[model samples]
Target: MTDRSFLDWPFFEAKHRAWADEVEAWAAAHAARLTDEHDADGSTRALAAAMGEAGLLRAACPADGKLDVRMLCLARDILARHSGLADFAFAMQGLGTGAITLFGCEPARDFLADVRAGRALAAFALSEPEAGSDVAALATTATRDGADWVLNGEKTWISNGGIAGGYVVFARSGEAPGAKGLTAFWVPGGLVRVVERIEVSAPHPLARLAFDDVRIPDSHRIGAAGDGFKVAMATLDVFRATVGAAALGFARRGLDLTVERATSRKLFGAPLFDQQMTQGAIADSAVEVDASALLVYRAAWLKDQGTPRVSREASMAKLHATEAAFRIADRCAQLHGGLGVVRDAAPEVLTREVRALRVYEGASEIQRIVIARAETAR
Candidate 1:
């Protein structure tokens, strides 16, 4: 169980605390039974269905059915603390349907209902081979073809790429050069087709999508024709904080496991926890974990309080939490000696998982840039 003390901070309200307890209970009960080793596609689908059955998907979006940053962060933190696969399952459910939740035409609303019901999986397809953090460098283009839009080019490093039922695709809309030319689309995955599913170090679902004149109705556009950048930015602003929350969860798990193991493992006629070195390590981890929690919830609370564009807060949270999670995981591995590197110990899995978080959702370096840009702009 998480330390309830974080709830006492000004960043969280009673409702957030209540939601945390509820999700924590659900996670404790169900996280262990769900394994993600083999049949990744099937496991992800099952995970989503289980999340839906638990009614956690309800919190993935807001009361108005829009994306709620606070709820997303809470769910990710809770689930990621319990299981990385669980967090991944929950995160994709929001990100995949985020565009529709924010801005979709008539048919998009019906599509969102499927997401809430777990009848379908959702994906966000914005990254490409040429574009990782540089959004302005994207080469994918979508043009109007009578009543439909014809899409061309490819999106790589896409989450839930092959498995999701639908995707919020971004492409150049011919408005102007750079970000302004981009537009977002709610394209059904079956309609777009996947080029290949790319395996990563962490073994989560990711793929490359090639749109070869993929025909989508004009009604599929999210926001205006040239507002893809705005839509994508707005969507990221909410979920980015949640990414940090997920990192916080990972760090918390690392701390818990390390503390438990240190107390139990004996060395040189005494428990590892008895050593000053071990105590220092644990203290450092605990402090960092709390710091991560503060940054994460601070961003969440700011958003809940109706602050616009938490780019700096989100960047700070994501950067700190992700970097700290890696450190915590590394320290856990070190504390375990050779056992930590073993697959059975889970640190090995966590090591890979934490590494991925540092890169995705904007890399640690990119986040630094974002924070600096925001600070300087102000």
Candidate 2:
């Protein structure tokens, strides 16, 4: 069965355990959204609305602005185990408004409640065609015009791009050069147009967007002109571990589904579990699932404890969990034989979803560099 055993670990508080129970029930109740193949945009919007109605979106926008990293991790773990699309909806709500949650003034933070309530959607517009993981290479520019900022550039691979009511955009504001020259702003979607829609193996409203001299008052800026890098990195610090948690969920689900299949599927007048070869595969995946969980929760616990700048821990968690989860999905798919390759199969779906996780937020190579740099600096 689905493991609720992680909730008892010391990484969680009593209230967190109770909250996990709630999310588990909610996820089970909405099993229909487990697959995100058809009409991804509509599915994402519907999932967000459902999660908002259930009050789960509150985790994405805590009233205190001090997000409980443990809660965020647990919620993502549960929801991802049930439906990755649900996790996507919940995660984007937090990530899309993460700068505001971290640095926005009262005026900018005003619309967060609307996002949390599902009345509006938000997108994180940082990656550009030339700058997927290289944040400094982004060509988007926001020029100062009197008291206003005028944006002109393009952003690609943006989640919730077209449907979002607003976006958290990062662009070069020329404070210094390279990374330091960036700034964060809140741009309404009305000012930007979706130029193209990009589809992946697992779909989720992916798009490319363009801004042509879109003007906004200075109030929309998320932080000071020179602070965009800090704002983006800091926001990533809060959500990075949760990405690991999502990967962990996928790994655990992979393990469970494989086990269920192995125990029931017969080969040569015996269950697949009776084969030592099958047992070896399942055993290896089980160990990986636990290892992934430990790394994921440790990073989250550290964040919740206010150990600021968890770049090392978060990177390690995300790197290992995503890689291991994909491996586990691969193993499970192999064990499933021909069924795994069929459209919409559990292993097929997970392999696709986990593959994307390694590329987004930061690539696996980027995360490895982040972790190694942190370690060697000591």
The best candidate in terms of lDDT? 2
**Residue-wise lDDT of candidate 1 within 85-155, one digit each (tens)?**
88988899898877777775566776677777767788888899989899888899999999999999999
Worst 10 residues of 2 by lDDT: 30-39
Off by over 4 Å in 1: none
- Give one digit per residue, the lDDT tens place, for model 2 in 1-378: 777787789998899998888888888887454445677887788888888888888888877787888888888888778888888888999899888988965665657888888778889999998998888898999899999999999999999989998899999999899999999999887888889988888888889999999998998988888899999999999999999999988888899989998999999999999999999999999888888889989999998888978999999999999999899999889989998999898889888888888988998999999998998998
Give the C-alpha miss distance for residue 272 in model 2, angstroms: 0.4
* Clashing residue pairs found in predicted model 2: none
lDDT of 1: 0.85
The candidate that wins on TM-score is 2
Per-candidate TM-score against the hidden true structure: 0.97, 0.98
lDDT of each: 0.85, 0.88
- Report, for all candidates in order, the number of backbone clashes: 0, 0
Deviation from native of the Cα of residue 281 in model 1, angstroms = 0.8
